[model samples]
Target chain A: MKVIVNGEPRELPDGASVADAVASVTTAGSGVAAAVNDEVVRRSAWEATPLRDADRLEVLTAVQGG
Target chain B: MERSASGVEHEPQEDMDSLVIAGEEVGSRLIMGTGGAPSMQVLREALTASGTELTTVAMRRVDPSARGSVLDVLNECGIRVLPNTAGCFTAGEAVLTAKLAREALGTNWVKLEVIADEHTLLPDPIELVDAAEQLVDDGFVVLPYTNDDPVLARRLEQIGCAAVMPLGSPIGSGLGIRNPHNIELIVERAGVPVILDAGVGTASDAALAMELGCDAVLLATAVTRARHPARMAAAMRHAVEGGRLARLAGRIPKRRYAQASSPFDGIATSQ
Candidate 1:
C-alpha cells in the first residue's frame, strides 16, 4: 500500500498501522504526534490504528517559533 | 546610596508583582518567542537575558535527520514551553495543532493563532473565537492572539480564555502600538490577563505596552532579529519592569500650562 507521510509518498506493507508508518520515518522515542487524514491519533492508539492506501499522515513535533 | 559596612552600596529591592494567567503565576512579564534566532546558543542567551518564564514554540513536521535541539536548550534553561499554532488558517487546523502540541509537549497550554491571510497574518476573529470555545471546552488553556478589539477580547474572555493576546501591529512588522487607545480599551474591559503580542520593534515599545496596562508583552522579531539579541533582551526586561513600575506609580496629568518648580515668592529681585 502507498501512503503519504509528511508530504512524501512511500510504499508500506499491507495492514501497516500508524505506528509502523511513524517508525519508518523516525527513530523510536522521538517526541512526536501523528494525525491520519486530519484526525489526531492519540499516542496510545498509534500501534492499533491501521493506515489504508493513500492515507495522508502528518507526524509533527515542536520547533522554534512564535 | 546606602553603604554597607564594607563600603559597598546596597540597592534596595523593589517589590515586584507576578503575572498570573490561568492560575499560573509567572514572575517575568516578558513572554519571549524562540523564532528567528541565529542559533540555539543565541536563543539560550537571549532567553536568559530576557528572564522570561514562558517562551513560545511552533509545531511542525518532524525531520528524521534534524540536528539542532531547541527543546534541549529550553530544558537546560528551565524555561516553560508554550506551543503556538502559527500557520493554521481555520479553527479545525488550529485545534489539531494544539492537540498535537499537547501530545508532543505534555502541556495543555497553547498560544492559539488562527491567521487569516499570508500577507497580514492577522487573526480571523470568527474562526479564532470558535477555536477558543472548542479548545476551552476540551480542557485546554487557550491564549488567543486577537486583534486590538475590545469587544472581541471580552467575547474571548466570556468563552473562558485564560488570556487574550492582542497584536500591537502586524506580526514581525515591528510597528509598535499602532492603536494604543484600542489596547487601553481592551485592558479596561477584559477580565482576564491582556498580553500585548507582536509589533514590538525596540525596548521602548515593550515599555510602552506595559505602561498601557498590559499584563505582559510577547515578541520574537524585536529581540531575535536585533543586531544584539542578548542586549535587546536585557533592555526589554528592564523596559517591562520600568513601564510596570511607572504605571503603578501613577503618571501625572497632562497640562497645558507649565507648573513652576520654584516658589513664586522665593525669586530674588534683580534690582
Candidate 2:
C-alpha cells in the first residue's frame, strides 16, 4: 500500500498500521503523536488502526515556537 | 531586617499576585516563547531568568533526523508548555493542530493562531473566531492570538475563550503597541485575562503593555534574538513587575499645565 507520511509519499506493507508508519520514521524514546486523515489517533490506538491506500498520516512532535 | 552589603535596609518583598487562567494560577505574568533561541541551552537559561511559569511551543511534523531537546529543557525548568498553531490558516487546521498538540504535549491548553497570509502573519478574525468556538466546544482551554480590536476580542470572549491575547502589532514585528486605545478597550470589556502578545521590541515595550492594563505579556523574539538572551530575559521579568506595580499604584492624570512641587506659600522672594 502507498500512503502519504508527513507530505512525502512512501510505500508500506499492505496491512501496515499507524504504528508501523510511525516506527519507520521515528526511533524509540521519541515523543510523537499521529493523526490519520486529520483526526488524531491516540498513541495506544496506533498499533490497532490500519491505514488504507493513499491515507494521509501526519506524525508530529513538539518544537520550539511561539 | 535584611540589609544589603552596602548597609542599605531592604523592604520586605510582597507576594506577587498570581495570574489566573482557566482556573489555574501561574506565578509570572510574562509568558516566554521557545522560538528564536540559538539552542536549547540558551532557551533554558533565558526561561529561568524570565521566571515564566508558562511557555509556548509549536507542533510540526516530526523529522526523523531532527535533534534538539526543547521539551527536555522545558521539563528541566518545570515550565508548563502551551502549544500553538502558528501556521494554520483555517479553523479546521487550527483545531486539528490543537488536538495534535494536546495528544503530544498532554495538555489541553492551546495558543490558537490562524494566520491569514505569509508576509504579515496576521490572524484572520473570521477564521480565528470560528476556530475559538470549535475548540471551546471541544473542551480545550483556548487562548487566541487575535488583533488589537475590541470588537473581535469581545467576540472571542463571548465564545468562551479562556483568555484573549491581542497582539501589539504583527508577530515578531517589534513595533510595540500600535493602538493603545484599542488595547484599553479590549481590557475594559474582556471578562477574562487580557494578554498582550507579539510586537514587543524590548523591555520598555513589555512594561508599557502591562502599564496599559494587560494582565500579562507574551514575547519570543525580543528576548531570544537579543544580543544577550539571558540578560534580556531578566530585564523583561523586572519590566513586567515594574509595569504591574505602576499600574496598580495609580499614575497621576495627564495635564496640559505643570503643577508646582513646592507649596505656593513657601515661595522665596528674590528681592
Model 1, docking class: high
DockQ of predicted model 1: 0.81
Instruction: Give each candidate's fraction of reference contacts reproduced.
Output: 0.85, 0.88
Residues B1-271, candidate 1, lDDT per residue (tens digit)?
5878998554455443789998889879999999999999899999999999999999999888887768888899999999999999999999999999998889999999999999999999999999999999999999999999999999999999999999999999999999999999999998899999999999999999999999999999999999999999999999999998888767899899999877898677886
Q: Taking chain A of candidate 1, what TM-score results?
A: 0.93
For model 2, how does the per-residue alpha-carbon lDDT over A1-66 read when each residue is reduced to its tens digit?
899999999999999999999988887464578999999999999999999999999999988999
TM-score for candidate 2: 0.94
Whole-model Cα lDDT of every candidate shown, in order: 0.93, 0.93
- lDDT for each residue of candidate 2 in B1-271, tens digit (9 for 90 to 100): 6779998555454354679999999999999999999998899899999999999999999877878768889889999999999999999999999999999889999999999999999999999999999999999999999999899999999999999999999998899999999999999888999999999999999999889999999999999999999999999999999998888767899999999987899668896
The number of the candidate with the highest DockQ is 2
Q: Point out where model 1 deviates above 4 Å.
A: A28-30, B1-16
| Interface RMSD, prediction 1 | 1.1
